[model samples]
Target: LLAAAERGDYAEYGGTSVTWAEMEAYFAQTTGFRRPLPWEPGEAADQIAGNIAWAEMNLDAAFEAARTTGWLDLDQYHQQRRLLIHQQLLRTAAFEMPAISTEEARAHYEAHLEDYALPFQFWMRHIFLSCYETHRVEEGETPTSIAEAIAGDRAAALEIRAMNHRRLVSGWDVPVDEIDERVGPLPAGFRLLVPGGPDRRAEVRARLAEIRESIHSEADFIAAARQFSEVEVRNRGEEIGPLPQRGEEFLPELEEIGRTLPIGEVSDIVETKHGFQLAMVTRRTGDQHRPFEDVRESIVSALRRERRNELMLDWMRGLLQGRGIAVDDVSSAEFAAADASSERVVARLQGEDPITLGELRANWEGLNAAQRARYAERPEEYLLAHLLFERTDVLDEIAEEESSAWMAPLLHIYDLVTVAEPFISHQIAEAAAQITEEDLLAQYGASPERYRQPARVSYDEIALRADPPSASPEEGVPDPTEMLMDQLAESLGSVNSLGAFRRVLAEYAIDLRAVTASPERSSQFRDVPLEAVPIEVRAHLASAEPNTVIGPFANQRLVRALWLISRTDDYLPPFEEMRSRVSLDVQAQRRSTLNTQWRSEALERERFELVRPDPLPAPSEATEP
Candidate 1:
């Protein structure tokens, strides 16, 4: 392949191609390279046998796709043209190797030295222990009861805590060597730390030990880790890379230590919410300006991208030069001879679809039938909500059209004041650039709230076992509680009213009735059985609506019911409390708006004159020489 390329044989049989001549000109202007001319000797033979075959194939496919899928559409035609031009440029540019000098690379590296500096921090890991405050259960529960519950649950928590200490951190204030593989700059613990509290600090401590251990050479610890570390695949004994430097990169207290550690040594255990980590600097490389030799590869890559871009423009320019592809000026296009002569053209362009009165009526009837079908199949409330979303556009248009004179001008102005930028840009690509800060701010303020979180409820539930076989032979039925509960539950679909739910249970033959009690006191009824209670009672309790009653249910002579005794609204901290989050959201919105507007304005002003509109545009103009 190399020999073929050297012989210029690759250019004929397979090579890059571009249609935009201007881009090629830009590349030539920027890099002082000779531009290939199509009419030059051997050009046609090259096209038949050279590397540009892939580009030609793509162009053929694009034209085929356009022809198959209504290429007569202006938008479709334009899209194909753009793609064909870009592909040609890419194909041509990639195969042509740039001839850049070492001196140029060095100069470029010197100019962008800051881009290559290493972060001034060490990543660490450590073992950690968390100090937790004890909270007693409500006064009524006995010590024995609490102890029993704790026995079942506390062992797992304690086991995890022990692992945190051993696996995450080492002893306090000790230098770190052979830091745990699990510990790094953006360690897992860093993500879970509780904000602004004592736990947060303790978490920081736990992670510090691991961080401290990483920097020093501890052959013994590394060997031990290779033998017994529980972190996945640690047993396979793979060498881990040094941690990255960014603080936000880590999950917990370890991140803090990583950001703060001195370059040469281990850091103290950093306590993170999940565990402790001791961080160590296995190796440190300080920031130094990159030499030309160091950044030569990157500069070459950049130049190639620029060159490809220019080649693409050049290919397009060449294609259009003698192709007779003409476009009317934006302002005068509306009055073009072809457009004016054809009524069909006028009808399509002016948003008028040629339809007879009968056809319009038929469409209206079809829509009415669909609406009726939807209404019949869904609940009224559900249907209403669905319609609200589906018909919002129509509603907005109707509201605008029907607006009163007194209100119309204000609304129009407000819309223009708000949507003018986005709307105009939508219609005319360049117009969006005209949107100003005031315009955006006005829209932003008027915009509906965009940062709401879904409403969530946290609740505890207890499910009692219900058995059908427990009924006596003489009884000829399941236990009253169970029977009543099931019967009352099945009485209706989706219980909504307390009275209706109660009526269901009253009609059933239950041994015990279902009841709902306050969540604060739910523990008192743990012994209740499901057979005795009503289904509505359980549903109501689950939902937690106020002033609801569950029916008498029976199970093995036991009764059950439900209650919704307490409720809590979804809680999100105030904006001031979440300033960082709000700031990020606001900034992202600003950036998106700014970038979109800038692109729109740039395009609109140029009026499709050219991608490189400047007939005299040079590639060197894109970046500093």
Candidate 2:
């Protein structure tokens, strides 16, 4: 069979013929390398021939099964293959496009000069002090007002602290590295040190004014940034740019500063909701046209692609015109209203079968949701395109004459795979069914680690709505949520038992059941995997003893208090408990073993030996030009 397939005379498997081209195509698909030619000295050709013969045998068996059982639709399979072949032919024709000349490329460039115009850009750098940290809301939860108020307070404090640090750093004459030494190391919770300073915005402006007096040049400004910048600008030696002067890319105030500031000049402090910022423009460029030579190759490639698309569209139009199919008169609304099973003729070629509404509906339904939505948006155009593609006879003829040699073998393999899949699955299922209980036990005993379960925790939790404060607190007035949290914490501190904790929760009008239930309406988690728990919750639960009340841990949306009910370390379940899982494992092991045995038998029956080729030599260093 191998020799016949290689000789290009093999004709069996319900009149399906195999050729050397098909063998080469199969070899490339499997090995990712072209098979050696007849005259080439290698064992690869023999190996590829063996694979081809095996595939053909399987295809033949599948074909016989289909014929005997009348289970497969050969006509549908052939139609799908014809569509693939037509696509391959079109791709081949498109890639073999006519060469585009430099003159043509230049003309296109001249006509679309705006496409190559470079925007006004500049180089600038600044120290950034982010007053507020961005927070990610938990799934199925909305941000609460209390959380926003807390964040706002924290941001206000941070702005004050950042301004103080800026003031301290600006007064120093030491180098960027030594400035830290001059200020001394910061203690833990150092950021909260200047929480209630003078108006933060006024302080920020005053600090910037002092810094401006000391910064005579761009280098001086950079040194000041290195000393006081909250972000990582200190470590970077070069300024970031030529960034486009686009409003969306940068803060509006920063973009305006970058656009209007003279080179090597610093701007006044610009206030934003996040924080105060000062920018210095280091370099600038005016809007300019890209030189034709710089983008010539790209322009040529673009023109080539455009030309190819036009050619393909024209070819499709000609095919439709030749068949006397006029899709322009077809309305999407008509098709939309028609039943999918309706047998009304939508279009047809003279002397050919009419394209039915049912056929069009079936084809449309085959597309995925995204593709269906795209086509539905312009159904008339889609109809025309589909009609053109539906001309399978023309497609097959063109593909036979123009498609690459590899396309035939690829199509054959695709058909064989689709047909043989069910038979292969049935065979594997039969092999798996032979697995016994004893086999499952032996496999389970051999792989004890696979049966071990990870540690899990069972807990009950109470949740509260910690919405942001609706109004800002006046001077010296505590936030409403903060006061509530304080009272709850004080109340929980005196509760020593689970019953007492439950009483306290009830007193607070908190319902644990309503807060923790999942969207599926399932009860709160029990025996959930430790790794699956949220990191913050996991930290507290990791070492907590049973019956311990923990949390009041608040996120941007909720305050959660958890009571640990039980916990278990990683352990293996009893054999009876894991019987179903072990049985599945045994069956999978058997299936894999059978597949290996079959492949080995095929190799032995054919007397074929695989030979790996020698590795190519590495390239030597090139001599200097």
Choose the strongest candidate by lDDT: 2
Q: With candidate 1 superimposed using the best TM-score fit, by how many Å does residue 514's alpha carbon deviate from the native?
A: 43
lDDT of 1 by residue, 1-21 (tens): 222232332221122332233
| Candidate 2 deviant stretches above 4 angstroms | 1-24, 27-51, 69-76, 93-95, 120-123, 127-200, 229-250, 273-275, 284-286, 289-297, 314-385, 396-408, 457-566, 609-625
Report model 2's TM-score to 2 decimal places: 0.59
Q: Considering summed lDDT, which 10 consecutive residues are worst modelled in model 1?
A: 512-521
Global CA lDDT computed for model 1: 0.38
State the lDDT of candidate 2 residue by residue for 118-156, as single tens digits. 787788877554343322223332112212344444334
- Per the 3 Å backbone cut-off, how many clashing residue pairs does candidate 2 have? 7
RMSD for each model, in Å, please?
29.4, 14.2
- The backbone clash count of each candidate, in order, is 127, 7
lDDT of 2: 0.62
Query: How many clashes does the backbone of model 1 have?
Result: 127
Where is model 1 more than 4 Å wrong at Cα?
1-98, 119-217, 220-241, 245-256, 259-267, 289-294, 307-625
Consecutive 10-residue window with the lowest summed lDDT within model 2: 513-522
